[model samples]
Target: MPEAHEDNRPLIERIAADIRKKIMSGDWEPGRKAPTNDELQRLYGTTNVTIQKALRILKAERFLEGRAGVGVYVRNERPQTITPAHYIEPAAAGQSYRWLTEASKRQQRGKYRMLEVAEVTPPVEVARAMRLEAGGTAVLRSRIGFLNDQPAELVHSYYPIELARGTRLADRRLIPGGSPALLEEMGYPTRSQDDEVAARPATTEEYVALELPGDVPILEIFRVVYSDDERPIEVTVIAKPAHRFKMGYHIELP
Candidate 1:
């Protein structure tokens, strides 16, 4: 079997990938019409069937959307590029969540819906990350995130019961400014963090929750936030459709 690399991909896939690259690189900005089938066929020196197949890939990935009797166009709501640090801070004492705050700054509507909340035994890795004893349980806060009314991310954050038992974190309602603020007020004060990112095929549940357009890989982030004295306060597992989002990181050197 051939390895899954650019060189080893079938012709149609490579063509689709190149077009995707153009869109991602901003060469083909959102709202712009994609090249016509005839034009794409001529450009790639391929047949209409191949061109159609390639375009279908982009459509399935949501990089393009077609209108009845009209041409395909780049999607208006472009994939979001999230800078982890920007939303890592606890929201101001009485403001909206940092997620909403940052989205407004970008001229977009950020929304959240609480999917579940319960004290449960988490996966072993989560248990280890939260430093809980074997068979220990924690408060789980699961939510689905939206941007411009479209589902964008699913987050499951686990908190130490000591910090959540009497608070909204254990409640099934959405947090006002997110749990980070409550954690701060309780004195843990999110002082630092660790992140582990991975890419894998979407789970059946995640595929349905994120409403992914196809059987595509999803970006999964395992994050642990700590407070003063290196105490872990929050451990979150985030899942987003891989084709519709990217992470940005910036480092400053003194």
Candidate 2:
């Protein structure tokens, strides 16, 4: 017997873990009916209550869904893969609107709504990333991006007021070719970028905006773009539903 099957953990926990492994390994595929409680009880020589408890655990983790009169089954939804190269490599090739381009490649429609654009006091973190003085103002461009009509990400881009004044970045309309192209035209070509990622419970506004499930966490990405001279050109904050994305990176070793 495998050690996991023989461990001293609670029998219900062990049973749940076994079923979870099977589901994840595709031994039991999505939308397939899970073993009935009676069948699990017989196989494990456990009581109905014990089997029920195990099923509850899987349901809570969104691995299974019960149809009451029907039966429990594995969830059909899967996370989408998001590799760093999807954005970075394209940008390196001078392709703008990378997000939209990626969506189109996946046969999904991508669109964005420019929510707001105004000169506002920058958030402390945004100010620090843009190297602005405390309480300094910046041009804020807020947008909501959608994939196949589903909200996928909320992005807020900040630019130094002096750099953005009278520029498309300060406009309330969608900029053709994206902001990067406009910045390049203004002599601040992007040279490099840094990204910081983290996960946390979604805020109320985020939950509503992304139409996310209760208690689901969100992936937060802070990206800072710099010019050839190392002057910060832009800072963008992105919020995405955690389950909707799987971030990846590729690096070469020295």
Candidate 3:
């Protein structure tokens, strides 16, 4: 432990973060036994009380669990893989959303709650992606997606006001086949998409809205969909618990 002045965070928080790092980095694989209490104390140069407190933190966060005299072990809630390719296209007419269908293929019941739909000034990054002028507003659609009745993802999609002003994208009700289908009908068929993925701590709104279990990193995706001539049509931002999702991508080398 660094001097208190050097590392102002509480000892418990610091130690918990260290252990969480090991787990997230795959240095401590799931189902593996944790270090002995004495072993941890010696490693951290801390006391038994501090070590116990840190372990409790991890336990409450579901990263570790105690057994009846069997010692503590890492839990088996590793991230599941998802292939973005499986969900890129528009759902056919009269069909449900693509995301719902894809989730079903994984044996997980899927659902979503539309939280908001309105015209709002988008974030700078979103505006830039869609080439909206400063202070320009877009039609914003927000929802919380659930798997097996558990909230799992928060999605916000923005559409250019020019195209969405008189369409379902600006409506409060759920679109029958999702935005991609509606866009295709309006002649903005999705030609290609680009996604920038990242990870960071959740915002306060996300933490409460998603009922996050702990302070785990959130996987963030900023995706832009284009039509013919590479005209940007929609921008979507998705956030989910990073520890619970593993995005799979396939690349072709020439």
lDDT, each prediction: 0.89, 0.84, 0.90
> Against the true structure, what is each candidate's TM-score?
0.91, 0.78, 0.84
TM-score of 2: 0.78
Candidate 3, residue 163: lDDT:
94
Candidate 2: tens digits of C-alpha lDDT, residues 19-52 = 8777756788878988888899999999999999
lDDT of 3 at 127: 98
Clashes of 3: 0
Clashing pairs in 1: none
What is candidate 2's CA lDDT for residue 59? 81
Number of the top-ranking candidate, with lDDT as the measure: 3
Candidate 1 per-residue lDDT, tens place, 113-182, comes to: 8889999999999999999999899999999999889888999999988888988888898877788888
**Residue 98 local lDDT, model 2:** 77
- Clash counts for the predictions, in order: 0, 0, 0
Q: Better model by TM-score, 1 or 3?
A: 1
| Model 2 CA lDDT for position 245 | 73
